[model samples]
Target: MEILEIENLAKHYEKFDLKDVSFKIRPGKIVGFIGRNGAGKTTTLKCMYNLVSPTGGKILYGGEEALKIEKRFKQEVGILFGESNYYPSQTVKNLTAVTKMFYDDWSEDLYRHYLQDFGIDENKQIKALSTGMRVKYGLALALSRGAKILLLDEPTSGLDPVSRDELLDIFIDLVGDKEHAIFFSTHVISDLEKCADDIVYIKNGEIIVNEDVTDFEASYLPRPPRQIRRYPSKRQAH
Candidate 1:
């Protein structure tokens, strides 16, 4: 069954527009949303999470209109953006404390586990942490929520190769239960190639392709060599 469905989704701004975007993410699948900068990938993810309103189209989560769903529905959705906007004065522990009030499923043990696994200092203030550390904390919070669907936007963008690989492994572990699904957006093709089961490519606010990664690679090949004109052989010309 489809875990998330975006139908004819569109969002408009003064200078940009997300035009007629549509796609489906099935349960237990990791789907990669690939696009260059300003390709509406973030906009689409925001719409799915109800962070921004869509000008047109509908987003359904497990048969319920996502926009109309109750707060409880949101409890099952976890989102991580490229940059975190947490309060700089707060430490990771403090942030987790505050988040616990909002999410009944929040697990303190798991939160601490992730902090250690990601090599993040729980007592350090957000402002003191590096950008990659902030991203790690954001992911920790998301995973601790016990959510079934993870919506990540460029989650590993600024990290080094080791950090990126570690984050990728964390995601893999998150979905090991086979009950969760992940929809992640990124420009790093190699990262997607490593973890994605399906891929959706967006260009200029439109979906260029959506298919299984293997299928895309199989169908995607270098263009054939073109015929080249050569000077007629001297013998043939004679």
Candidate 2:
């Protein structure tokens, strides 16, 4: 079954208009949302969670309107708009305390595990982290919420090659469970080659290509990986 469906999503700005944007994200897949800058990728991501209201169309999760089940949708579907650094002066520990208050399913064990795994120093303020660390920290918060689907926008933006590779590994590991999935936007096609299973290419606010990465590369994207590594179907039926 498809995990999420975006039907005829459209949004309008004075200068830019997103038209007929549509896609489906299936469980057990990494769907890479690819586009050039100012192609409405971030705007489309925001519309999914109602951060920005869509001009038309539906965001459906489990066959129900996502906004109708707003609280549950927010809880079960994690979204990170780029690397988050909302309160630059806030210590990681203090910020985490406040964040935990919002999620009923927040798992302390998982949170601690990610902190250790990412080597984030909780005592340090947000501004102290390097670009890579900040991204990892945002990931830790998103992953610890136990969300089955993660929506990430430009997650690999400022990382060095090594850091980007490590982040890609984490994305693969997270979606190893068939019940979990990721939909991330990136202009960095090389990163998608390493992990993504499907490609959703948007151009000028419209979906131009939606297919397996291999085909996408053969038909369009020039930089294809040596191979794609997909780790899916590692879970029991619910």
Q: Which candidate has the highest lDDT of all? A: 2
- What lDDT tens digits, residue by residue, belong to model 1 across residues 162-182? 989988887777677788988
Measured against the true structure, the TM-scores of the candidates, in listed sequence, are 0.89, 0.90
lDDT score at residue 87, model 1, on the 0-100 scale = 92
Please provide, for model 2 over 1-238, each residue's C-alpha lDDT reduced to its tens digit, 9 standing for 90 to 100: 7779999999989999999888999998999999999988999999998899999999999999999998999898999977778798999999999998999889899989989988999999999998778888998999898898999999988777887888899889988988899999998878889999999999999999999999988887675576866666658432
lDDT of each candidate versus the true structure: 0.85, 0.91
In model 2, state the lDDT of residue 127.
Answer: 97
Evaluate residue 192 in candidate 1 and report its C-alpha lDDT on the 0 to 100 scale. 77
RMSD of each: 6.0, 11.8
Error of 1 at 218 (Å): 2.6
